[model samples]
Target: MISEAYSPQTRNTKTVKLQADLVVVGGGLSGVCAAITAARSGLKVVLIQDRPVLGGNASSEVRLWSLGATSHMGNNNRWSREGGLINEILLDNLKRNKEGNPLLFDTVLLEKVYEENNITLLLNTAVYEVEKGKDDLVKNVTAFCSQNSTTYIASAPLFCDASGDGIVAFMAGASFRMGAETKEEFDEGFAPNIEDYGNLLGHSLYFYTKDVGKPISYTPPSFAIKNAEELPRIKNFQLGDHGCKLWWVEHGGRLDTVHQSEDIKFELWKVVYGIWDYVKNSGKFPEAANLTLEWVGTIPGKRESRRFEGDFMLTQKDIVEQRDYYDAVSFGGWAMDLHPADGIYSEHNSCTQWHGKGVYSIPYRCYYSKNIENLFLAGRIISASHVAFGSSRVMLTCAHGAQAVGQAAVLCKEEGLLPKDIASKEHIAKLQLALNRNGQSIPRIALNDTDDLVAKANVEASSSLKFKGFSEADDWHPLKFGLAQMLPLKANETYSFEIEVDASEATSLELQLKSCSTPNHFTPDVVIDKKEVDLQKGKQKITFTTTKTQEQDHYSFFCLMKNEKVKVRLSDERITGLMTVENKINKAVSNYGRQDPPADINVDSFEFWTPERRPKGKNIALQMAKALPIFEPDNIKNGEVRPNANGNTNAWVAEIEDKKPTLHLKWDDKVNIKSIKLFFDCDYDHALETTLMGHPEDVIPFVVDNYTVKDASGKLLKEVKGNYQAINTIELDEAISTDALVFEFSKKERHIPVSLFKISAYN
Candidate 1:
């Protein structure tokens, strides 16, 4: 409780009046991202949040993972195209704490906000009042900080209401709607035929667990449901564990999600603790005896709340028809997961599908405020009909929506225009270009005809390409690999085949087949041998050469790196004599290139391999001959090794000896190095570090190059910098590279004691 009186002399009491180019209220996923995007584009941004932390319901307080539509369902770890501020948060979290938990979410979110120098974050502050001019545009916002008992007056050229509740819009005199609209209004099939103007779906607190063997004796609230069968048209009990999750049935029945949060919190605590007590007391399973409660969310994840009026309202018909919007900005693939409008057990549990496909497009028009010139709305607050909102309310879709809004805010700040100005073709094109650069996928209809490629391979294009390809290859059974097929190849001829797959599902593709000459020694191969491609959505073409064959052996083709490292071997009988590759027993070649041999070529031990076998007087040709280089810092004169005395000086040390020399370093400091110039007395072409020798502190000498560091056995230790500065110092944070520090000077610059110095390191 803070006093209402203000001491003008005190800094806390002194009302700080500030202005910005853009003001984003609510530092949730959407607001944070919007502020970041706008700020990155040179906009002076002020992000105000009612809570202390960012990330809204996905923050540590709520303890929900920031999942996108492409998240989960086997695509959890893949790089999302909706990678901007959200990606930065996730990447920072992963870097700081690789534990894959939500505890680090707030820190990462703050880092992202702080990383953008143009963004100002105002936390633990609530927008209490709004000032508007005669034109009905928001002039300034008054935010009251309960913690400091101070009110802040802020003015901005543009405003965004990403508060999830649309509080800013409501205060700014913007038109909005709550609860379900009349059936005639939206013409939604699942909408009640009668008008029951009331509260929308109940907010819930979600939790997760991994213990398998457990049947807790938890009795749900009389209001809470036991199964999905209680709802109309929901008969499937096999919808996976999510069907039985704690929050799957519990809800706080309230109209005002913002004000009723306390009630929701009370109900959530009841459900969470009740379930925990039941699980603890009930002797269901011995495995769950140690089942621990990982997290308990405080904020209720409100699915449907305030829907702001925008330039255009996205309707259910558009979703069903898969209508392509010229101003499309985001997409959603999750089904219309509408919760019941009333009691814990209500008729409406889910929404009807448009087509067999569960994906839909959302346009840019749905993201901005109705009357506010430069204001935008993201997340659940977007202007979509209640029916359409049911499908677009998922977190992943919201993330995409947030990303688009962020980009739109940047455009608004840059072009000095309103959100409606972005509706034009050129502006949308610019937005799409930014999105593509950031890896977000924009669905497009195929203009050119590539149907002939599938037809030539005796395949037909179906309504949806994903299931069609799998259906056609159903008869083609899997071998050692799960499912695969082999087709005979023509020598020196290029053949093309297209595979249509769900971009959201497929992670990668490998057009693997046995090498022609290695009849007995099967070398698992890829058509495009140099690069690895992610074949998620769209079509892919595989082309390879069958120049010669040593003997008559079958080659294999299949998809590897599936759910696990296992391979899916295609059918070989369809095109007999064609090889089918197996994923097992096949090792992928390391793409890291070899380093040039040091100037003083010395070898304590040597190992070499050559293509010795010949077929029909045709000798196998060697592609290239090379040896791994080693750095002997001890032999090089004027190469004085020393410890880096920056920050944690104890972490690293450099030394040399009569027989062996090494760089001793702790694996805690991250160092960047450039070129390694060693001075020696004699002219030599190469140098070698012995595998047996271990120097000071038992540290092995490792050669650090541009791209990678390799040990004596030529095993990769760490990813190296491709290009670096001349004076950079190579810091060893991980395993030692080589036991003996050997280096070859390009020219004889020094004699006596070989020295290596002027080692510089930078970011």
Candidate 2:
């Protein structure tokens, strides 16, 4: 182990023995997420950040926008919820900051970490020395801060090196590597023929400006590139100067970005100001009178430095082949975006790019030090070759990697095991389960027959079913529905069944059954009937049941609609000319008293298993269909309507023939509803202008039904009341329970324009 001998004077200067369950060194995105996750999991967390803010390169110091795992071209998928603290911070920013500037971003991230009860953040602090036990486990870290000018010792059961430079791992005797590896070492497509440890990608200090209105005279800096050939081409310019557009490439002779940050800063400042001067003085921006500088990132955005050594090192080849690891904990999809070893100014060189076929899973073994038992690493510091680092270094992926490491750290703490020891299959399964519960999408797995049968038979099945769509009619077939068919149901007996679909493409499947008897007089009533349930992207399911009936039924079956919508109904009531028994049975069940049934009958339990294919393009038709019902009201009225002697609105009437109606109403914008009520005119039969009331600003009109409405005390409200005949009034008690609400309606001729009267509170 690398040990630094301390003198008596050094020992005497330190008084406090700071301790925690985990110590995260670095306040960057990955480090902050790590600290938050560990802390939230009930671990005592201490986070040390060198700067006052917490977001690292994407922080106010650098001003880089957070990018996710999909296409860098603004089409990639975002990081999943298992990204943990980062996800929370992102969601908060998305809600609070509509402009999405960097200053507000820093405050939000800092506040989130500070608000955590289990976290202690140390700002403006740097770890100067790391002490290790004889067995190579990190013992303690001594950090010094200019704010105090005194060295402080922080000891923790586990340590995470998120410093981007791998400082803690390096000082604690962990093996590591720097710069590009040889092709022979990692077999990477972009690797050099021989190892070039000295030549690495440098860092950048980015800045931006807003082009307001006025023209301001300016001049280009002396160092500004006058010719097209001299300008860096890789950093493409955007419509506005408020982005990562300037490359200012540097080369082999002066490529130390971290060490020569002052020089780089000077050059970057000149470039920024020079661009503005050119736009103003050259008359290129004649109307740009009020061009104002918005933000100048102070810290150097370092891309590469040191990488820690772990039990298994990730390589670029693993990404190309779409390799899967049993211990996989994270996935990276960004291409190998490698900057030239020389600065952006090099004439013969620019940035190098290598795209991946798809996302590749990262194993937990790559996150911990090979020699140090208690030491873990995340972000750009994790064990990976330089080429592999190019792919994994993006902010969102790094955040995900940090979350995995943090969760694993908590697991290790709870189980009293080292990181390496916890890298087994069983432990990985537990970790995967935890991540899944937090909304992370892992790779898919199928279940065996025995597991499938058992899961279906249980009333509360824990598993979900899979359905694959086929283009050819002959290819359509039944899968594992026999168990459901054979299940015994007595006369007047009620049973609930759940159906889950994990198909990547929209699929049509038939639920069929063989012979059985009809319901008797003692059977319960069938109350619910819903047809055409649509499953959108990702995993979706539906549950329904017939009335409580002890009837041995027969020949019950469902035919898949060509459009792939699932139909369900609870009925013993026979339709005209349909099969019926003398002793018909239908039962009624209370909606409030029933529990949610299992996901799917005869399905297997597995993690992250989505069907191989799904319908292509946007499901616009499905979305529209779902939206149509909310706009159509049963009653309506054109003018003033009055209630009858029975307290019912006689003015409200259903005009079945005219096929057109109007609705009018006003609300307090703070209510919820299961359905909308419309007062229409006597001239129309159908309701139009289906105005809905009480909605939150953040709730999108298209996604209204996805969430449940609730009141201040979290009580569920009843459905709204009305029909498509004439103007009618609805009480707040009939609306769904919610603290906030909004109005939604359809544009039709027969609908009456709504007007607000008065809303009263139920004391």
Candidate 3:
């Protein structure tokens, strides 16, 4: 027997108190991105997740794949690869876990959060209580950790309810909507006519099955539905198919998807087991004798719940019209996909309709609470009508929304303003600058910073002014049918492209110009001009006149048809927003889809091509005038980074051996410059990759390893050492008055080949 004198106290709960600049509730893709964005901006952030793992629905527990602007390869959004952290995660997944393993993806999310030292992640911590401080602002939130029986009271100036269910907003007395709003509310053409509100999109359960090479026995439980026709969902089930392969296997939306989550999950369980019983023991599938249930998700992935209202309610009309907001911070392209009220049990298809012309913008007004002064919302909980949520609900889109929220929150904290004040003229520009500086894309918004030194000074480079080569040269191949590659050309100008052809016989090639009204669409809107030429073999140049008459430069979809054996140069490398793949007659899946059935793509071959982001700068004339991916020698300098979209190598790379490439900014007279910012290419194309045997990086270490800035007197003003970040913002110790500023950068000891996207200076 032991005495109790020396025993320590054992309490039912342990309390932890924390204070941070920002507190993000919910650890989904949106939450992770939001936390990371704010934290990376040098703010103290605390990210709290209810589940043990990060990535919310993408976590192992839920097992849903992240889908967004790419639209699961089901649509024509070929150029809509999301930029920033979302793009990083996707490319990383492609390189590392092309298999799309839920557990492996979970680790990537976990590692990203863990690597950010400014973020305080509290896993297995569910926030259930929130209190208001002075001026009815959110002050503190209380989260309980069931794993350790610990309670955490997190305090912050701002809170983000990325909970997907709007938990934080609900607890903070924020105004929110539960279901579909009437068309009269927002003039949404797709809105349900009757408006029997509260009938929401449902929850889904996913499972994976595998063949073990041996017969597996399964005893059907009493609750299993014997007949496949009972639910009508068994027909879609196939052996070895898993995850969202069975997306329609859903329920619980007609009811309260949040409060009745458990009930919905229980119903889903019965459906899953019943279907498996039909596949194995129901005598319908003898081939499944060796198949067994590998894994089934216990937690249900909720599609719609409580949506906190903001300054703006994004409507289907807004998406269809592509309404541009002055405070635009992010974009969404997934169609306005909506389901029937009955969900999977409905007689009609699971998805009733998809709206919107193409990719659309999401504004800053819809990201923050209208009534709750200190609360910001992201993910599915953002302010959108039922119709618009269908588009913005996708994971990557939500992550971008979170990125905006995080950035805006940081700006708010820094400026000491409330959530609603970010829309002012001065602060809105600051917010956009922050997003653009971090590589977040705001569609059609170009950074024309006035303080750029290169814009005012004469620029020169050591290399050829023309782009060296075409990105699609290696992708060239023979095509029996006609192939088209869109060329971006200025109106009333002539452009030429060189082709390398090896043919058994002479071929008659017909070239035609297809007009494009929508700049981003992959196919030609109409055919306007045509030309024909006879080709011999080896190498040849073809010229065409850009007569579309559009004032601003627009894409010209040019089609080529060979009457004989001829190979045309083609490179359809995947770059963001440049080359898009689409032929009117031939249609194919652009890439892998998360919803696709289980199959090893490596062993099975598929040809993918799209000159979607083809760089117009490859034309010798344009390269001489416009500055490109880096600070290359060009006539025009708008201080934009990686502005060209259609090339595999978007950044300007210096000569292989000439590591010390110096750029001179010369003006007519001495000017006072206060600061300069440099944009380097961290290899945006290679920014992400997930591999089993090797670890990849978020940024390619191919930037200016060493650099020096000098005044007209040749005196060093600022010097940077061991540089790796994508954007470098420098504040001069004192304003220097000089006619010329020199930037001299060198590669590392091993000939690193420095790359710069853009550089700007401000007074």
Candidate 4:
């Protein structure tokens, strides 16, 4: 190569032009999901990110675990994990990166995006300019990449702004709010006071540690704060705490979170180094002598910035009341968590969280900008009041809502309509049906696709599970606190239960039968009956029959109040629609067994009944006088996918001893089918956190590991092995005309029985 001679005063950078049907800015989970979803839905998408890697906060650069509705299993939201593309990502992560290595997680995200041919990925590029057309539409966007010394001009008919700071939205002159609103503004009694709790949420930095088997020495930089004792929350530190466990190592709520991000990062670093120094040399953590810092986040994970306005702003009332919306598109269940302005130095507790009795719906109106016609708002910047953002700002929740944005973009292109037009009555149903077909579950909404051939076929199974309760007792569980067994029952039915227990001494056991006022909710706020039984010192059997029948079908809680002298028998058998929960606290999420907030906060106070993580959470060993026939082959055609508190188990489960579980669909005439989809049990109640936490198994135990599909002639059409996902979409090489179809599942000697939620055939 030769250098240029007598060059001009300056030379411009290389410029490139790109076009797409949809342009997504920001590589966080929300934007990544949006781009991938739209790309799969037949849209040419361009994904732009300022960072080198995708996943934003969930990337190796920042490393915060992705959490949503399950909330670490700290609350009462059961079987509430987010579905659709995000669920697939989480399941994939579990299979490949069960150890939760952030680097591996980054690769998973990259692989997912790379698998889609319609997506164009641009990384290490920041968008700094925008070009607008007539009628307040965005015609094009300009971005510059310092790493490559290149400038990119990308144009698209629709745009989505998932950048953490809403950079594109701000440059496009979108209306936004930077701080919290007044308590009286939206009747949000839980709103924070500006002078006390502060107006904005803050940024946090995390680190990882490892043991070298030898003493490791560390010296702090000149900028590191030597006065570690001055930290108000210093006593809360521990040698083993790292990653998201140190989420409280935050700052910059009082500063400009967007403009002064560097300053905020520096402050967080100073605190992190100071905290490490304290752990190393402070003489309090003798066990940390061989530990050394393995990695530290280069940038802090931002909590909140500028929130853009949409057609309708979500408020505290919507979350607390669990309100339903006509334009509901998504849902959120994380508690409303708010931090203090002083962050690590704050005198108040690290955070105050208040949760609703159940998950609430999110409307489609809060997805797109109100003034910016062609713009869409996603992630933490979606339209919501500060109090509501405290719950909806989580990564999976943001990603789920952004998925709706992706699907909406498809409808916008197909109908030649704007994003706002999709919120109308004429198009809302279409949007919901499309999302449901894609495996996204909306709360309280069932898929009613008339095009599915299964709706017309008669479903018959070799054997169905009869609800007779688990009888094998494997261990004894002490009743140190209140314990409840969740069981599904029908209306106008009297059920009898027989429980075996061991008593340390003579005591009286209080058995309370309870159910939620709302049939679809898990909160057992209504007490139906109670009984007091006396127990002797030895083993005993207690039998109780319900005196009254419930008015409607719902899951009732058979609760045994705390009686330290007694221990109940537990079975190792685990079922799809059954679980045992305890009234306990998860301290990490501030669940104190029961939430008794001050009356002025305008929040509800209730007990938290959460399930234990497996290998430990076993069902109660009891017997029912009569078996209930709830799991029938006809359930396969039901509109609901998962078992609900208000509805019966919308699944067909084979008997435990059924050697070869089979399902047959018969039709009067031959039908041409091009595709077949099957929905299985992956245990939606488990919170599949993306990073840091290790899981018990790679594949969900309840999922069908091996299965085969056959046509009317008994010719093998397709076979699936080692399946771990909830939705299985199989496309035939050519359309098959048959009068019937049969599905056969391999029997495995495991705790979970073979089961299926739904099956559909389409041409």
Candidate 5:
């Protein structure tokens, strides 16, 4: 523990007073994000966590691998990821904790807080009291430091309740609900038939094993469920399986996940210890001879508890239907996985059913307490039905909300308004803009800030866009029976659509283009065009075009369908509107469940493309032609990070063959500039696995390896050497007055192709 870093006194008689623009309660992913985001936006923040270390469930104590909307791309939600603060954690984790060592992971989170000058982190501080003033606003919070024994009273203009259990909100009398919302209550098809069952997803504990190399004797725990049969509900138990799999061990849903958190933890411990005993001591486990217990968690990861009420309570319907909200500030793509409250004791399955299409939007109204004027909420406690919560509760998804609320807190402080006030139509856009400017991914909101030169100025490149990526075995879809590919198309426009087919014989192929799933709400609806073509066995391209009448929706998603014999190309490419959807031919296998070429998961979701782009340098132009996201020089000023970090689609590409390339920026008004920040194409989606088993994401090749900044007169202003990180910045000794500035590269990293995600200059 890092307790020695602070005072060692166990008890203190005095009260400590502190003040800040924002005070975040809880140090989990949500709180970490909320605190860091607000602090980065120029607000003083006090982040308090009850634990001696950080990263709640994902901490060494619990050891749960962080999961979110993308579900690790290869797993599901192919095109999804929690971009802002959560992504930063992933990237930093890639850089520092590639081995996935829990202790090192803790250090990364702690160091991040320490690096943020605007944040004051107070560890082992448990908040137990909240002060409320007129209009139900929070005045301050009182927390007791366990080690130092000092009571800290932190007063701030705004407060964020990321305390997994909504402790701060509960103490402040924030309205909340426990248990499942009735199916009719929110029209959640996934809700239990019963009205309001308090049964919730349970708590779970994890254990790690090490190979002793030599056989070792085993000792059985007295409380071990010796005959694994005692827990028949848990099937396919294996010593080799780990990480969020059912075999990791879970329990306690029948009991209150919050009020009985301790009791539930104890029960989970019994289950974990017993399982190990059964694996080692019972005659059933011969493979356990060489494996020994390396570590077991003392703390259990709690899944559900008190969910605070917000302006809009997210319902299962919202997730299944992919509801669009003008105030949307975040999104979640994890399936609505609801386990029976009975947990291990019950005979029911862990999850009810995986829900509809890829990632869905999360509105801003769900981030703040409905009645608590100053209380904003993040993490598992945010307003969402048990079913929807099943999906949003994932750590990375929670981190997304944390970023939204953090940005909103900045707005609340700057505008001198309440959370509700910021929710107003007038101010909501400002909040979104702030989030966008900071690189948070708010689904469906194209980064179109006027300050972005790409969105306003004329853009040109040295070459036309070239598409990269080979058509591998996993790069195409067999469009037959029930599969379709979503293609974003313009209204009343006809464009050539190509298909790559590998048919064994010249089979008659019937193809159709249909609208997106909604309103009609099913695949292959409102056919825009239909054609029947004969195909050959080898790779062949068939181009078909269709024009929609103006009567059709101004812009609608169209899907391409083929007969059973046809196969369509599924590029690893990232295109603005290329999504995939399919109907399950059988209940056991969902189109969304296919990972062969994850981009073609049958579920109606965007193709999950990790680091969603081609390897750098190879597709410098073709991917650009496919195009908008091809890291055009305009993207530098687009005010958004590439949707997928490691991918090239959302990045601009350049080849360093002859003279090093240069990017020149000119302003008609000639404004004074003080600092410049450049975001190189670091391949955010470049497959970064948090384990030593895999390799690190390439250190983005296009980073300004060595570059010089010059004025319009060609005079050198600044020069940087051997740059390798994603973000490189230089604050001038003093503000320089000029309408134009130039960044000329002397040398560029060539390990991979060069790419840039974004660049920003500020006064």
Candidate 6:
């Protein structure tokens, strides 16, 4: 076929006009979350991405692991993983790709967005221009797609700029900052000196390697750094280390990370290839002979660029002090981590981090532009000082905050309001309640949902867990470092704990009872009592009694100080609200048992009592004086869905022996229930890092994999199998009028009990 048109001046690509209730201008984790949440909340949405796939930094291109409050279980954020759509995504990834393949994670994000009918996903579309309406409102966004050579004009009432560089906000003339703030500007003592530390963090590139079963050869290009073996960070490179493990291989801090990304990529490639050459040619790594480059990132993972301004800028003080916000919408626990400006080339440490005693709340005021009326800020571009961005810039934290922005967009459309209006006193609670209803956990805010019919019904389970404590010893955990058993205790209650211990020699063991200054926090800063017990050489029982209770309910730490000769018994029984943490060092993140920075740094000095990963982190076996009745059937009607800081399980857990556990709900009058929402326990303490981390199990052991719902006559209403997600919503073909409902569950694992957080029925 011959084409016959050499017509006029120039050919114009096709231009498409799209409209929706909300327009999301990025396809990163945050933007993907925002688009999905808004669409699920009944908003017509348009999702535009500059890249070929979703999950910006977490995508296959960048290969960064997604993490949030759990912080790799390397900190004191017990059961503090993020919730909502991001939680769903991570759990889904865990179920499908526990091996954490970046490509598989890409399909998960794509499937989630594609399944939502309200979302119009446009990939490889870069938004370059913005149209403004009256009173500084965004009217429409104009983007061009090089893949298809088409222009797209997407118009919506509200817009969210989760683009890492704040492209939309920048083009719309929004207020923003690109570099570090002065110490005097935000009273941040951890602020870096712009000259020595550099004002901005840099970008990072990662590569993966595989064993080819035979010897392989590598020849670097002429552009590669020839003397990579002489680099300052040469010692950090290991033979098998790849991807984010080699996160120190970075560049482009002195230059503009956005405008000079290509320069950074070239430098990173040179360094990466040069490092491979050194591994092959140098005599140090003999084990790398068979290792071949499996994959390498095309684009560098950006750490910082332009952070748009909103009504309030989060500062280091807020994170360090664990400040509460009136309009708290989300939370973050990643240490205030900042990278050296010179990146891998610097002689200084690759990064510096400081952790707060507990997780801190993120306010709604930091979610929308201060001047741009319709612009919603999310991701790393949210309003925050450089000191705060070190913690909030992580992908999961950004996605958690974006879930709030998504719900706020829906509220703005419904109430005929702007983004700023949702943070006010009258509207903030509504927004928070909506977020909680959708599985987003705001630190102290419980969802006081009055519409849930389960709240009005009388609930009774076949059997509820009585906290007599796990006495079945599976192994003996030696006291290499300080170990503590975290138990939720009742106020003014006398409790006695009997622990089995083996001492190598006759020695005195020091025991302490401690609790956090804040009742709901996990930080054991306040000591209630201390005692020293004499022990013999052989195995024996060590008992402690405590009647000194706090003014309110809280988690008590039964701490056994570091004793090299003592070994305590550990139970394999894993419960919903119980755990044991040790005071030790995780050098990977620079945690050295305790943080004692210079007093002038304005950061707290505290020990990091973190939990060990699975197949190892077992609870201490003990016998309680009395059974604690915290896990009652009524907990299913409570608004709280996850384990809270107060140590309340917020769930009804069946006894381990109750094989066919069933819950019965009785109501006075028949109620119309078209849908049912169930919340399950997913072990939030486990950080489901998206890539390069192998999980012990595909489905969290605590989740109820098989369950069935029955109506008054014991007729099956709904059945679920192999469920792994935390939130499950079941919609019936038609509403059923029933005065009673019965729920039967089967235990997935023998050691882990079946538990349900909350249940709701809607007409």
TM-score of every model versus the real structure: 0.55, 0.59, 0.77, 0.98, 0.80, 0.98
Clashes of 5: 30
- List model 6 lDDT by residue over 355-418, tens digit each: 8888899999999999999999999999999999999999999999999999999899989999
Q: Select the stronger candidate by lDDT from 3 and 6.
A: 6
lDDT per model vs. reference: 0.48, 0.51, 0.68, 0.89, 0.66, 0.90
Clashing pairs in 4: none
Give lDDT for model 4.
0.89
Candidate 3 wrongly placed segments (more than 4 Å): 1-12, 73-79, 88-99, 193-198, 229-235, 282-287, 352-358, 450-458, 464-482, 494-511, 518-523, 531-551, 560-580, 584-756, 760-763
Indicate the worst ten consecutive residues by lDDT in candidate 2.
616-625
**Which is the leading candidate under TM-score?**
4
lDDT of 4 by residue, 545-639 (tens): 88987777888888888888999999878877788998877998888889898999889888888899887778999889999787898988886
Instruction: Residues 66-124, candidate 5: write the lDDT tens digits.
Output: 76765543332433556656776777786666667777778879998999999999999
For model 4 the TM-score comes to 0.98
lDDT of 2 at 533: 48
Q: What RMSD value applies to candidate 6?
A: 1.5
Candidates ranked by lDDT, best first?
Answer: 6, 4, 3, 5, 2, 1
Q: Say which prediction, candidate 2 or candidate 4, comes out ahead on TM-score.
A: 4
Model 1 quality (TM-score): 0.55
